[model samples]
Target chain A: MLNIKNLKVSVENKLILNDLNLKINPGEVHAIMGPNGSGKSTLANVLSGKKGYEIQGEILFDELNINDISVEERAQKGIFLAFQYPVEIPGVNTNVFLRTSLNSIRKSKGEKELDTLTFLKLIKEKAKELGIDEKFLSRQLNVGFSGGEKKKNEILQMKLLQPKLSILDETDSGLDIDALKIVADGVNSYKKKDNAFLIITHYQRLLDYIKPDFIHVLSKGKIVKTGSAELALELEKSGYKNL
Target chain B: MKNQNLNINQEYKYGFTTDIESIKAPKGLSEESIKFISNIKKEPSWMLDWRLKAFKRLKTLKEPNWQKPKYPKIDYQDLYYYSAPKSSSNKPKSLDEIDPKIIETYKKLGIPLVEQQRLNGIAVDAVFDSVSVATTFKEELTKKGIIFCSISEAIQKHPELVKKYIGSVIPLSDHYFATLNSAVFTDGSFVYIPPNTRCPMELSTYFRINASETGQFERTLIIADKGSYVSYLEGCTAPMRDENQLHAANVELIALDDAEIKYSTVQNWYPGDKDGVGGIYNFVTKRGICKGKNSKISWTQVETGSAITWKYPSCILQGDNSVGEFYSIAITNNHQKADTGTKMIHLGKNTKSKIISKGISAGFADNTYRGLVDINEKATNSRNYTQCDSLLMGNKCGAHTVPYIKNKNSTSTIEHEATTTKINEEQLYYCNQRGLDQEEAVSLIVNGFCKEVLQQLPMEFAVEAQKLVAISLEGSVG
Candidate 1:
């Protein structure tokens, strides 16, 4: 469902992702494990259509090249990037922003927009499933929220958006064990036969929950190795140095 | 304003000038011009004398240069001091008697001149150019003992009241602009709430400058009698003109014993063009006095237009246990300059005051907050708190804060806090990634920064002010 061919990403002439190529088919979870400076987040950003980068090659989702699409259009086209560091917007209520975003997508898709009451009901159910209260939704988006709460909120958005391609960039980095379980459960619930996920991480811990179908070791902007789910455990014992 | 990704530098939609027949005085600032304006209004001998005295003082009172703005020398002789709508010559006894053309002008300006009979709960006094065209809900307010009428009408009908309170708070010799406005002021609103009564509805006045080359000088005086309460709103707009127009107006509020007055203003004067070719030079002096024991006054303003703005809405707490509050949101975009804040003087024992200001600068514009808080020796146990925050959209813009505080009494307490922040790129990207364009993202972040001050505005004005904040920052960044 997602394809990248000879994708080269650079910022200010400094290459971050060099000749990277990866593909994830429907219903398959691909995990990219890399250490610092390994271009894991760069790959996530490049796929999400972020600016300020000199990118070469092509990215295709569902056979449609999305390199020229804007970030907002990419979002409407079902491309979701779970940021490593969520942005904090003070004064904007989280619930209002979320509803507007959802309605924007719904409008473009020619679907009936949900009224405020209906939107509230849907968000409340989703929030309860993720252990979020109405009070949290009323606060400014991510302003003064804890690390775990931010991660949970990200997953909540992912579940609501129901994007076809989800790129989880370091989603498990700062999460505690309980938060990790909640996030994994949220992602797992959104998993469908037609949807795909590219989970990028620095540790093998998250693989124990989401259980990737394929594991790849990314080094110096390229995937150096590919293996099965057991590879995560192997790396946890042997480390990437012996890969 | 729709496509956030598109660079914001859009043309001002309200820039179109309306063609109205006007009787104008010759371009100049002199006793002759002042006399001409007063003669047009057919003022009494005392009113005419008042203008002549103010004009004499205006020649000696030089414009204050302590502000942070830099503008070219204003040729006072090049501006027409009086421009009155010709239709105003025949005073309309009722709404139906008003000229259709003048009513059409107000309709296009989004000001509903004809009362719709619905409980909109607002009494509008529409002032076009130098004359008040219509005042709605006058009879209803009269039943409540609320004297709501044009200052010109007040002078003719209630001469005793007008004579007693005119220039009481800000004397004619107060400042340069105030003196000039005093000498050539045309038409404005005068409100009075009787003792032990509350105004049934919000009193509003829409001030519009229609004719080009005509400077708008308005005077607003609101007096809340003992144990009375009233809320007043003022809005201003001028047709787009290439030459810089001056709006030097004065507003005075008198809160008598145990009375409260809440005043709000939404200033949307033409901010010139995108290149800042021409706009209004809004230099206004607004001051309120808490005269009686336990009286209170509050000032809320959303300033988003004009090429240059110099305003300081102030309060003097003379009544024991009185309170004063000032909430402002000043935005400068596209080469606009603004130096605005508030002044609070504590003279009564246990008096209290609070100030909250938010300034936004974008597109090479400059915004500054200049505030003052003074506690007299007799104001024992008084308290004052001030918070000033600034937000910048692009690299070329600037924001500044200058706060002057003095406490003569050891028992008084004063606190001031200031912060400056930029519209974060990460936050914009995050919102963009979530399906909002750059414009929406910027608007969201900016509105967040100004939430405190926006909350102080009335519910209806709050929504419009939020949209104004977004529009003011449109295409500010390349």
Candidate 2:
């Protein structure tokens, strides 16, 4: 679903991601395990079309170059990035944000947008599955929310938008075991043959709940090793230093 | 790049003018001019004398310069004090007799004066230029013993009520702009709710300034009798002009024993071109008095237009247990400037007041909130709460808050909270990443910021105000 060819990223004369090449097909789950300062988050940000990054090489989504596309266009084109630290937007209700985001994507896809009542019903079911309270959706987006709640809210948005390529950037860092399972369940249920997942994490704990098709170890802005799901368990015992 | 983004190209939608003959008083302000206006309205001798007294006081008062915005000097002698549509000379007794051209003007402005096309459950008084041409649903209002008519008509028919309440809340010689309004004011709405009765519908007045080089000085007075209730709204718009136009208005509201009054304003006068070539200078005085026990008065305003605005809609809590509230959202974009807030004066014991103000500044504009909360010695146990928040869009714009508080009684409490926050870049990116464009993201964020004040507006107007808030901040994002 997503193709990167020697993607290099730099900010203010400092190189973050150097000569990174990766490819993921439909129905595939790829996990990038890296140590601190290995530029895992930078790869996630660059894929989301964040500004202030001097990029080199090419990014292709379904064989179309999206290097010039804006952040919103990328989102509308079914590219979703779950932030490590979700922004706390004061005063914007979570439900309203989700509806607006969903409608925007729908409009771009030449589909009829859902009305308020229909949207509420759909979002309610999605929130229930993610173990989120209905009251949280009515409150300001992520404002004064617990770490677990914020992560769950991000997953709720990912499910609502139904993006083809979902990027999870350390989404399980602050989640408890129970919350982690709910989040994994949310992803497991939504996985389809036409969609894909790119999970970037420092720990292999989340991989226990949701197994990945392939695990890649990234070191110093380069992928050093690639293996099956058993590689996560082996790395968890031996660590990235021995890779 | 930021300057290019801030260069807004949206046209002022209500800047069109209608071509029609007008009977204008010669340009100048003098005793003769006041006499000319009074003669045109055919006022009683006592009313004329009172206007002359105000005129006499206006001559001795100089314009106040305490506001933050400073403009070029205004020559009172160069502005046409009164300009009315010539067809309105012979007042129409019914809709058919009124001039079709005048009615067409209001129709184009989205305010249908015709009987069948009138707005449902809302009575409107359409003021074109310097005269009130029509007031809808008059008969139905009269059935409930509610008096709703133009000030000119009220002076001629309900002289007793007009005489008893005129200048009661706002004295004739209170200040410069107010004194000027009292002297040369042409026409505005006047409402009176009878004792023990509630106004059945919303009463509104739409003011339009179609004549160039003319000043619109309108006076509005609303009185809610003992145990009565009323909600009144005022909206104003002016055609685009190359030379700056002046609009100085005075509004007074009074609530008697156990009565309540809710006043709202959506002022959308022309705010000049983006480069600040021309626009309206809006200087208005609005004050309400809670004159008896348990009375209440609330003021809600959404001010988005005007080159420079200076107004403070205040409340005088004179009755024990009375309540006062002020909810305002003031937006200034381009080269516009606004200095607005409210005043809460506690005079009786156990009174309470609340103020919520939201100011937004975009482009090269400047927005300020200046308020006063005074608790007198006799106002024991009285309390006041004020929250003022300002949102700035770009570095070129400015937002300031100046609050003055005076508490005399030991038991009285005053709580004030002020915050100034800039639009965060991360927030915008987050919204964008959720599929909302830049403009939509800004609008959503701003609407949420002003939600508290927007909820205070009537349902019909809240939606319009919300859209205006977004439109006012257009092109402000970089």
Q: TM-score for all predictions?
A: 0.96, 0.97
lDDT of 1 at A169: 95
The TM-score that candidate 1 achieves is 0.96
Compute the lDDT for candidate 2. Answer: 0.91
Q: What is the lDDT of residue A235 in candidate 1?
A: 92
Residue-by-residue lDDT tens digits, candidate 1, B125-168: 98888889899999999998899998888878888888888898
DockQ of 2: 0.58
Q: Which regions of candidate 2 deviate over 4 angstroms?
A: B1-8
Per-candidate local distance difference test: 0.89, 0.91
For lDDT, the strongest prediction is 2
lDDT of 1 at B427: 84
- The number of the candidate with the highest DockQ is 2
**lDDT per residue, candidate 1, A79-175, as tens digits?**
8999999988888899988987898778767899899999999999999998877799999999999999999999999988888899999999989
By TM-score, the best candidate is 2
lDDT at position B44, candidate 1:
88
